[model samples]
Target chain A: MEQLLQQLVNGITVGSVYALVALGYTMVYGILRLINFAHGEMFMLGSYFALTLIVSTRVGVLQLVPNVLLGLLLVFLFSMGLVSTVGVVVERVAYRPLRRSTRLAPIVSALGASLFIQNAVMLTYGTQYQVFPEGLLPTTVWRVFGVEVTLMRVIVLAISLGLMAALYAFVQKTPLGTAIRATALDHDAARLMGIDVDRIILTVFLIGPALGAAGGIMVGLYYRQINFTMGWTYGLKAFTAAIMGGIGNIPGAMVGGLLLGILETLGAGYISTGWKDAFAFVILIAILILRPTGLLGERVAEKT
Target chain B: MSRSRGIALFLLAIMIVGVGGCAQPKAEEKKPAAPAEPIKIGVQGPISGQWAFEGEGIARAVNLVAEQVNEKGGVLGRKIQVIQGDDKSDPKESALVAQKMVAEKVIAVVGSYASSLTEPASAIYDEAGIVHITPSSTATKLTTKGYKRFFRTCFLDDRQGLFAAEYFSKKGYKNLAVIHDNTTYAKGLAEWTKKYLEERGVKVVFFDAITPGEKDFTPTLTKVKAANPDAIYFTGYFPEGGLLCKQAKELKIQALFSGGNAVNNPEFVKIAGLDAAKGAIVTTEPLPGDLPYPEAKQFMEDYKKKYGDYPKSIWVILAADAMRLIVTAMEKTGSAEPAKIAEYLHTQVKDFPGISGPIIGFDEKGDRLGTIHKAYVVDDRGEFVPAP
Candidate 1:
């Protein structure tokens, strides 16, 4: 029972990270109806950005700043901002140009963008893995309800939940959110109704990557290691989370991310860790078979 | 006489003496004749891919050895030249590299790091009757393939697997879980470990194969947990191993975890987190770092001076040693001919002292003979501290 409880804790921590990354996947897909493959690389960008900030500022200039939390906040903001610019540029260069070409064209472009970004990262940083800097975050273990949780895992969950809530408010209540929803419902109709569809799509890309970057930064802090190849694995899992919740629904993505995390963690803990990957895939397959549309997704009629 | 005329006269006298000296070497006191062409030693490895670090280290170490040999009046008066080619760490690429080296007429080929790469490439070398010595290949089947030309300066994975299993049994870790990457090298090592441990009356709770390069390992860990094994042995590289350790810790499966040489990396400590990696044991070829051998310290010093960082693996020194052996054998045989050098290597390579340990370049089957393995635990800071 203790072993089961322990694995459950471990799974949930990993799942939380997956959920955070999946939120970006779900939100971008929700608003734009495009799977932002480069979102994973965006997460990678966030990590490198945090790494850069940590190295340049904390190690170099921020020696004068006595408070650790202040240093962390600065590092986090810089990472998010850097990744935001990259996200915007990726959309402008890769996705926007193919806005009207065809659905296949944009999908292909996103994959190319992903490859391009990963290689660029490889070239810029190096092919070898870099260990995350030490002492940037607390590594203390916290005991909760007879279950062990690390300070890093708790931070990852709390920060991710906070961002998800903020994203929900931004999409549902704000004018920009209204514009995004209007455009997502009907691109042509939204355009006719005086909503700038292109701007909305751009906004979606911007918001998604920024959130992804935040998640990425959190991952580096939580895992204490960063490499060029990290984004693809977590990104794939997050995509699975988005699909499980209904790909284009914001709330669904959140639900999907959390549920997938818990399920994967609990499943791996209780059932079999060897079957963890298979179990995650089984959920996707089961969902696809049982409900062609995801939990929150509805079938849209094909335009002839 | 004027200054210019006197200088010209002196130069003319020196030129006559220089010409006289060139023609003075006669029958008895003459040095051996320099060969018409340089003796080419082929250096094959992945110089530009994932395993490029190891390849570059191998090539650099070999070239350094070649440089030292040439400075001491060259090998058999013919300068030893290194002809390098990138294997790209792929089997097909490695084979092509071998064929290219053979076509170039190299006296001997030196690398192809991983056993997978060496396995196919060695066949090409064997067919061509070209001598190939792998500095780092550790697969058991390479020597077993009846390739008379093939040799490695390290123990095969099976041997190390047995060593790890024995260590576990001696420590009384009776209930064990075996997880291996589903590769020929990893699986072979894991299988050998399982068989050996079982033979010693240890209860093998689980033996599982995980796919290589998969990111999430929670499911596998969960299953290992289900078996409730006292210890776990993983046969995979640090990338997945680190993540597995991290995930395993999170799942609260506190079984003592160990791995093969693949996990003997600094990246493992950082990736797995220090707390997670604590108490994790790994069995690998004896590194020059811990060995008290005299040459080990010298190589570490020279290597550190040449490259601004510590060498990644202990086998790199052995790689360099193999290069020295080939050049020395060529000189001893008084020829750069492949057949002569290969024959000399077999006959004269007994009890050769190298950086790793005593290396007999050829056993009965022409495989490198070495018997040194070390066990280590990752400290809190991630450095591999030799086990007490």
Candidate 2:
């Protein structure tokens, strides 16, 4: 039972990152209806950027703060903001050109962009895996029901959940988010209503990529390591989560990410961990077979 | 009806045919006349991607050896030329590279760092009648596959696992938790150590195999801490192993963590941070810095001079030695032919002074007759200090 609880904690922490990153996938799909395959590389670049900044600047200023929490907050904000800017630029250059081309064009362009970014990083930073600087996250353990919950788990869970809530509020409350939803539902109608669909699409890319960047930074901090190839498996899993949660459904992405994470963790503990990856995809298959639209997902008429 | 013109035309045609025949023989004669053509050797490995640095290290060492041999007035009065190809660490790609090397008619082929890439690729080289040697492939199945043409310079995972287990027992650690990457190398080492440690009454408290390339390992660390093991044994490559060490530290697991040669990479220390990597132990094939042999020191100097970076793995030295072994066997047999070289290798390598250790194999199975593990600890500065 303790093992079960620990696994649950593990699942939630990782699943939260997946949910956040998957949210980006869902949002981009929701608005532009493009897969944005380069989204994973965007996340990778975010981690790299955060790693460079935190290690070079904030980590050296340790004498200023007797407490470590303040140092971490600064690192998170600086990294997140930088990654958000990167997201906007990538969308403008890579996706904007293919917006009017054939459907296959954007898909191919996204893949090319993904490869280009991954290889560029590989060449510049080298193929060596890098670890994040230590002591930025807390390590204290709290015992609950004979299971130990470390501070890293708590932080990852809180940040992920916190980000999800913020996103929810933004989508439901903010004028910009309303424009995004309106454009997503009916781009032509939204444009006729002076919604500026292109601006909304750009905003979606910005938000989605920023979330992906946050997830990437969180992963590097949580795992304490980053590499050029680190984005592939996580990216694939997040994509699966987005689809399992009904591709374009925001809340569905959240549920799918958490469920996939929990299922994967439990499967690792109870069944063979060797098959854990297989288990993540099994949920995707099951979700596709059952409701098809996923929990909270509503099927909409196809646009001609 | 112009008989004189017909006779002149026939004589001209005969003259043209005679010149063409003379030119063809001239080409064939040049081949035999230049019997001093350099003895061609092929080197293959991942010169790109994640393992590119290691591959380039091997290539540099091989070129250094070639330069040394050529300076000494060539091998058997013939210069040695090294041809290189990149495998990119993919099995199918490795096999294709091996085929290309074989087509190039290289006397011996050296390379491929990983076991997964080497196993399939070695079979291709063996089938193509090329003598293939690996610098650092540690899979148990590689030598066991009965590929007479395939050989490796490093000890396999079982030997590495036993060395770690023995060190743990010697250090008086009773409770142990092992986490493996579920790869052929990692899983094999972990299983071997588990069996060996349990036999000696060391409590095997936790055993888990994690997926490779995953970013989060909080769940695994949580399990390891809950089990309260004395030490954490990880048998995986640097990429994941480094992260595991950092995560373990972040979780305050505080147990001794050790891994196999895969974690010997300095990148592990850099990635895990010096604090997280401190006190971590890893068993690796001997690095150049750890070499006590005079020949090894010379080889190290040559490698550093040529590559301008410290040799990445002891495998690079082995790769150089494999080239030496092939050349030595060729010299011993006094022939450049593959059949003669293989026959001579079985007899000549008994006392061959390899850079890693003495290259003494009893049979073709490739167990180095006098090689043992060199345990290393990651210091606070991230340098692998040889564990006394």
Candidate 3:
């Protein structure tokens, strides 16, 4: 029972990261209906950016700031800000130009962008796996409800949930959120109603990548390791989470991400670790077979 | 019509000139070989991916050997030329590299760091009747293919796995868990360890495999914790191995964590951190520094001076020794022909001294006759030292 509870905590912690990244997929697909495969690379770049900031500050001008938390916050902000710009540029260069050409064009372009970004990072950083700077985050393991949990895990879970809650409130209560919703519903109608559909789309790209960057920074701190290819596995899992939650549904992505994480962890813990990844795909297949549309997906009537 | 015909003629003339221009340089270059032609040896391995460090390290050692051989009046009075083929750590690319080496007519090939990459390339070399020596790939199935041309300097997974299992059992570890990355090498070692442990009346309480690049192993570690084994054997590369150790310690799993040669590197300690990595035992081919051979010590110094960095892994010495072995075979046979060199390596060469150690020739299966394997544990100082 303790083991089960322990895995549950681990699953939820990992699931929150998936949810954070899944939001980026759901948001982009919501507005642009493009998969934005390169979003995962944005998450990877965020960690690299934070790594550069932290390492660069360790010996130079920023070393005067002895407060680790303050330095970490600055690094996080700079990384998220830069990664958000990269997300916007990716959309503008790859997706925006092929907006009307064909749906397949942007999807293919996104894949190309992902490869380009991964290789670019590899060339710049060298291909070796880098150890994320140690002592940045406390490695204290806390006992909660008779289950062992790390301080890093709690921080990751809290930050991810806080970001998700903020995003939910912003989408539900704000005018810009309504414009995004309007644009997602009907691009032509949103533009006709004087909504800047392009700007709304750009805003979605920015918010999604920023959240992903946050998740990236948290993963680096929690795991204490980062590499160029780390994004591929995380991205694939997050993309699966998006699909499971209904591609364009925000809250659904969150629930789906957590569910997938829990199921995978439990399956790995109880059944076989080798089949952990297979469990996610099995659930996906079962879901697709049982309900053609996802759990929260809406049925759109076909026009004759 | 006349103007179009003239344009076609002009284009055809340019094509002929282009074809002739390329052929003339090749003929001219070959004409100057009045003496013995340089022996060509192809070095194939991943040069630009996750495992690029291993490949690059091995390639540097191979070049170093070639330079030293040339300095010693060349092998058989002919300069040794090393040609490199980058496998990119992919099986398909490895086969392509093998084909390129065949096309280059290399007398022998040294290479391919991982077992997965080496397996497919071995088939290509075997069919071409070229001698192929792998410096680091340790999968037992590699030799099981019965390919006469294939050989490896490193001990097979079964040998190392048996050594580890025996050590654990002798240390009174009754129940153990086995984990692998599902690669040929990892799985083979895990399976061998499990079989040997079971045979010794030791219970393998838990067995699992994790995806290669997955960062989060808490779920898997949680399961291993539940099993409550006395020891945990992880058969995978250093990156995942280090992560597993860190997570296992974080979970407060008190079981001893051990692995194969993949965990025998400074990077492993760096990733796992000193506290978590301490006492993590790894079964590996004895490092040159650890070996008592004076020549091994000299080779280490020479490697550092040439590469500007100490050899990080045993693959460096293994690669250099492989090249030296091939050149020695060529000199003994008085020819660089693949068939002659293969014959000499398979039969005549017995206890040939090289930098890493002595090559006691090869078995019928092309496995090295006698490869020493040792167990090392990460000390508190973050260095891998011989386990007491």
Candidate 4:
């Protein structure tokens, strides 16, 4: 029972990051109707950016920083800000130009962008796995409800859930959120309704990557290591979560990500860890066969 | 019209004959005046991926040996030219690289570091009638495939596994949990280790396989925790190895953590953090620093000077030794031909001293005659020091 509880904590902590990255995939799919395959690279770049800021500041300007927590926050904000710009630039350069072309064009462009970013980082930072600086975060393990949990795990879970909630409120309460929802409903109709559809699309891109970057930072802190190719694994999982939750559904992505994470953890814990990845795909296939629209996805009439 | 066409054909033949006559003397003149064409030695490995550091170490060591040979007025009056083929650590890529090396007309190839990469690439080399030497690939099946040309400097999986099992059992860590990445090398090592451990009357409390490149191992570690073992043995590369150590420590698992040679790297310590990595044991060949050989000490210093870091792992020494062995075979045979060099290596080389250790040439199955492994523990200084 304790082991089950421990696995649950592990699952939720990992699930939150997947949920964060899934938001990026679902949001972009919602607004642009493009998969934005390069969104994962933005997450990778965020971690690298955070690594650079933290390492440089710790070495050069440690005295100016009041505490490690404040320094971490500053690095997090800077990395997210930088990755948001990267997301917008990727959209403008890779996707915007092919907006009216064949649907294949933008998807292919997204893939090309992903490869370009991966190679660029490889050429610049090298291909070796880099160790994220340790001791920045507390390493204490807490006994919570008869389960052992590290401070980092608790922090990752709390921050990720908190960010998701904040994003939910922003999308539901703000005028920009309404514009985003309207665009997702019908792009042409949203444009006719005097919404800056392009601007709204760009805003979604910005928000999604920012959230993804936050996930990246959390992963780096949690794992204490990062590699260029890490984006592929996490991205694939997040993309799967989005598809499983309903590709363009916001709240559904959150539910899907957490469910996938918990299922994978439990599968690894109980069944066979070798087939942990296989479980995620099996669930995806079962969900697709059972309900093509996903569990939380609403059936919509196709406009031919 | 027929007379004119005959005259044009005769004129073209005369022009071709004139060009051939001029090229013959020029080629002859260039051959004698210039040094013998450099022998092309191919180096294939993952130059860009998770294993890039190991590949770089191999490449650098090969280059270092070549530089030393060339500086001493070349090998057999011909400079050694190292042709690099970056396999990117994939089996398909490894085969492509092997084909490229064959096309490049290399007499002998140095690497394809990981066992999964080497197994396929070695097939290509064997079919192409080229000698292939691996510095780090340790899968037992690599030699058993009847590939006469394939040779490796590292110990086989069985040997490493037996050594680890003996060491742990003698240390009284009877209940153990074994984990692997499910790759050719990792699974082979894990299986052999488990078999030997069971034979020694040690109880394997838990055994599992994890996917490579999966960053998180908490779920699996948590399961292992429930098994309540005295030690956890992970047979995989350093990336996951380090993460497992860190996560296992976080779970407050009191079991000692140990792994195979793949975890014998500085990156493991770096990723696992200093505190978490301490006392983490790895079974591998002794590093150059740990070896008492004077040549090993020199190699370490020269390597640091050249690469700005100590060798990433003992694999670098193995890589350098592979190059030296090939060169020695070439020199002894007085031929750079692949078959002749292989024959000389098999028949004549005996207990050849190398920076890594004394290599006893090849057995009938083309495996190294004898190989040994040493255990190292992560010290408080974040270095892999010889375990007491």
Candidate 3, CAPRI quality class derived from DockQ: medium
Write candidate 4's Cα lDDT for B1-388 as tens digits.
Answer: 9768755754543454344334433443454366678888999889998799899889999999998889998777899999999999777677668767766667789997899989877877776667899998876788889977788888778888898999999999989999999987899999999999999999999998988877788999999999999999999999999999999999999999999988988999999998899999999878667887777889898889987988867788989989999998888877677788888777887888888778777887777776568899999899988998
Clashing pairs in 3: none
Question: Please, what are the lDDT tens digits per residue for candidate 4 over residues A116-156?
Answer: 99999999899889778777777999888878888888898
lDDT value, residue A221 of candidate 1: 76
Task: Give the runs in model 4 whose Cα sits over 4 Å from its true position.
Answer: A59-61, B1-142, B145-153, B292-362
Q: What is the TM-score of each candidate against the true structure?
A: 0.80, 0.76, 0.80, 0.79
Off by over 4 Å in 1: A1-4, A59-66, B1-124, B139-141, B209-230, B246-255, B273-279, B292-313, B319-355, B358-365, B368-370, B379-382
TM-score of chain A of 4: 0.97
Clashes of 1: 12
User: Which numbered prediction scores highest in TM-score against the true structure?
Assistant: 3
DockQ of candidates 1 onward, in order?
0.31, 0.47, 0.66, 0.66
Report how far off residue B331 is in candidate 4 (Å): 14
lDDT of 2 by residue, B1-388 (tens): 5668655644543453344334433443454468788878888888987788888877877888888989998887899999988989666567567656655667688888888778766766666556778877866677887776677777777777777778889899999998898777688889988998988888889888888888777666766777899899888888878888877876667799888887888888877778888889998766677888888888877777866866867778888888888888877787776667776766567778877778776366754554558889987677989987
For model 2, the interface Cα RMSD in angstroms equals 2.6
Please give the lDDT score at residue A147 for candidate 4.
84
Docking class of 2: acceptable
Better of 3 and 4 by DockQ: 4
Point out the worst 10-residue segment of candidate 2 chain A by lDDT. A59-68
Error of 1 at A296 (Å): 1.7
Which is superior by lDDT, 1 or 2?
Answer: 2
